[model samples]
Every structure is written in structure tokens, then in C-alpha cells.
Target: MQIQLNTDNNITGSPELLSRIQKVIDHELRHHAASITRVEAHINDTNSAKKGEQDKRCMLEARIAGMKPLSVEHRADTVSLAVSGAASQLARLVDTTLGKANGSEKGGVSIRHLSQNEQEE
Candidate 1:
């Protein structure tokens, strides 16, 4: 899957951060990589230097073939935490989406017809 990262000014949005986020997403969702076309992650600081905690927000959108886009959001005290939390959510979302699209429920058996020779055995 191709991962695209975005962040507001309040967040550092460094290349290292983006790389780390991408790696997390890739590792978490590796099984669904083929079906997924792209992933867009938006990170921001809701409080923007405010004194209160849990201000960072992370929104992730994953696009899969023959299915509606799947999204997940998480809030944390820092951008890294938000990213990690969101990535985990996105992983589960992709897993369920792929399962449904494959006409299976969480890796359930897919019944199929067998050829005449094979069926005889």
C-alpha cells in the first residue's frame, strides 16, 4: 500500500516521523497490502500549544479495490502516539474490509466447486 502523510503546522511533520508511520502501517497491514491501493494519514494538534492534554489527532483513510474507503481516528497527547493508535485501528479496518470483500468472515472457509475428476476422489 502507498502511504501518504500530512500534518498541520503545530506538528513537526518530519521525514523521520513520516517514515516511522509508514513502516508501522506497512507492518501492521502487510497481509492486506495487495488489496489496498493507498493510505492517507492526517495528523494535527487540536489544542495547538494549549495547556490541556490529549490534543493531538490522527485520521487515517485506506482505499481498497471494490470497496468504500475505510477510516479511523485517534487522539493522544503527542503526534507519535496518535499515529500509532490510528495505524492499529486502520489495520483492523483493512482486515475486516478484505474479509467481507472476499465473501468470507474473518478468514472463514470459501466453498467452491471441484472438477469432476477431483470430486470423484
Candidate 2:
């Protein structure tokens, strides 16, 4: 899978930072490597460097094969926290979405809807 990193004016996109983010994504999406095509991450400061505000924003988008891209976003005081939160959410989303695409039952329960005629009978 491929990964792209983007940073707004407030945050700097360093090589180390990119490596760290990519590592987190790879670790979280280990099982879905085959189905996931690419992931793009964006980090920005929502408050524009205002002092006491929790404005760090992280956005993640995962492209799944034959499926629309799934996205998640998180905000925190630190870029790391926001990125971590978004990464976890994106991983869960991929699992749920791909699981559904594979026809896997959800929550270990299956429900069937009966027709009106069958119910009457």
C-alpha cells in the first residue's frame, strides 16, 4: 500500500514525521494490506496557533480496492495524539467496511426478514 502525507502551514512535514505516521498506518492496517490501495494523511492547525486551544487536526483517508475511500479525522493538542486517534479510527473503519464487502456477518448475529405472506402463513 502507498501512503501520502500532507501538512498545513502550522505543521511541518518532516521525513521523520512522515515515517512515524506511515509506521502507525502500516501497523494498524497489517491485516488489510492487500485490500487497501493507498492512504493519505493530512495534519493542520485548526486554531492557527492560538495558545490554549486544542487545535491539532489529523485527517486520514484509506482507499480500498473496488470500494469508496473511507475517511476519519481527529483533533487534539498535539499532532501525535490526533494522528494516533485518526489512525485507529481509520483501521476500524477499514475492518468493518471490508468485512461487510466480504459478506462476513457482523457482531456474530444474523437477522432475516420474512415476507408478509410468509409471516401470515
Candidate 3:
């Protein structure tokens, strides 16, 4: 999947930072890479130069082929932590979305199979 990184004026989009963010996102979404077309990451310091807790904000948007895009965001004390949290959240959302699209049974029941069960009952 292609990854695009964006940062606000308060933050610098350095090569090292971009590489690290890419690796984190790649590792988290490896399972759904084939379905994902691109991922855009937006990072910023909410407090700018001021010191504050959980000021680093990271937002990740994943575009999947033939499906609506999904987005998730996280805030933490550090940029890495924020990105990690957002990636994890996005991974879970993608897994749930793909599972539903494939009609995978979730919680031991599938909505598509519910009608059959009702008729039998």
C-alpha cells in the first residue's frame, strides 16, 4: 500500500520520521495490504511549542478498493506513540470492515445467515 505523510507547520516532515511512520503503518496493516490502495497520515503538535500532555495528534486515513475510506486518530505525549495508537485503531477497523464484507461470522453469528435460522425456528 502507498503511504503519504503530512505534517502541519508546527511539525517537520523529515525523511527519518516519514520512514518510521511508514514502517509502523505497514506492520499494522500488513494483513489487509492487498485491499488497501493508499494510506494518508496527518501528524501535528496540537500545542505547538507549548508543553502539554497528549499534545501530539496523529490521524490516519486508509483507502480501500471498492469500499469507503476509513479514518482513525489518536493523541499522545509523543508523536511515535500517537502514530502507533492510530495505526492500531485503523488496523482493527479494517479487519472488522473486511470481515463484514466477506460475510465472515462474527461473535459466532452472521447477519446473512440470520434469516435462515429464523425460518427454521
Candidate 4:
């Protein structure tokens, strides 16, 4: 999937940082890569120059084929932590959203179908 990184004025979008973020996202969402068309990561420091707990914020938006885009955000003390957290959240969200859309859970029978079978039985 295509990955893009964005940073606010306070934060520098360095090559190393971008690469690290990309790796984290790729690793987290590898299983859903085919369904994902693109991912955009927006990171910024909420406190700017000041130091604070959970000052760094990362927002990840993923575009899935034939579905509306999914987004998740996280905050942490460090950029890496924020990115990782956001990526993890996005992964779970994508799994659930896609699973429902496909009318199956982890490649198994659909819950709705199961309920219908039970009623008939």
C-alpha cells in the first residue's frame, strides 16, 4: 500500500523518522495490504516546545478498496510510541470493519447466517 507521512511545523519529517513510521505501519497492517490502497500518517507535537505526558499525537488514515476510509489516532510521550499506538488501533479497526463487510469473521461463517440457521432449526 502507498504510505504518506505528514508533520506539523513543530515536528521535522526526517527520512529516518519517516522510514521508521513506514516500517511500523507496514508491519502492523501487512495482512490487509491488498485491501488497503493507501495510508496517510499525520504526526505532531501537541505541546510544541514544552514537555508533557502524551504530548505527541499520531493520526493514521487508511483507504480501503470498495470501502470508506478508516482512521485512528493515539497520543503518547514520544513520536514513535504515538505512531505505534495509532497503527495498532488502525489494524484492529480495519480487521473488524473489513470482517463485517465481507460477511464473515476470520474467514468463518457469518454471524447473521448462523443466527438464521438457529431460527430455522
Local error of candidate 4 at residue 19 (angstroms): 0.6
Question: By lDDT, highest first, what's the ranking?
Answer: 3, 4, 2, 1
Model with the higher lDDT, candidate 2 or 4: 4
User: Model 2: which residue pairs collide?
Assistant: none
Task: By TM-score, rank the candidates, best first.
Answer: 4, 3, 2, 1
What is the per-residue lDDT of model 4 for residues 21-121, given as tens digits with 9 covering 90 to 100? 98999999999999999999999999989999999999999999888899999999999999999999999999988878877666456546456769577
For lDDT, candidate 2 versus 3, the one ahead is 3
lDDT of 3 by residue, 1-121 (tens): 9999999999999999999999999999999999999999999999999999999999999999998889999999999999999999999999888888886734134545467778577
For lDDT, the strongest prediction is: 3
Model 2 root-mean-square deviation:
4.8
* Full-model lDDT for every candidate: 0.86, 0.87, 0.94, 0.92
Cα-lDDT of candidate 4: 0.92
lDDT of 2 at 101: 72
Per-residue lDDT of model 2, residues 1-121, tens digit only: 9999999988899999999999989998998899889999999999886865569999999988778889999998898889899999998888788767767645232335767787677
TM-score for each prediction?
A: 0.84, 0.84, 0.87, 0.88
Q: Write the per-residue lDDT of candidate 1 for residues 46-104, one digit (tens) a residue.
A: 98878568899999999987778899999988777888899899988887777776778
Clashes of each: 0, 0, 0, 0
Cα distance off (Å), candidate 4, residue 57: 0.2
- Cα displacement (angstroms), candidate 3, residue 9, comes to 0.7
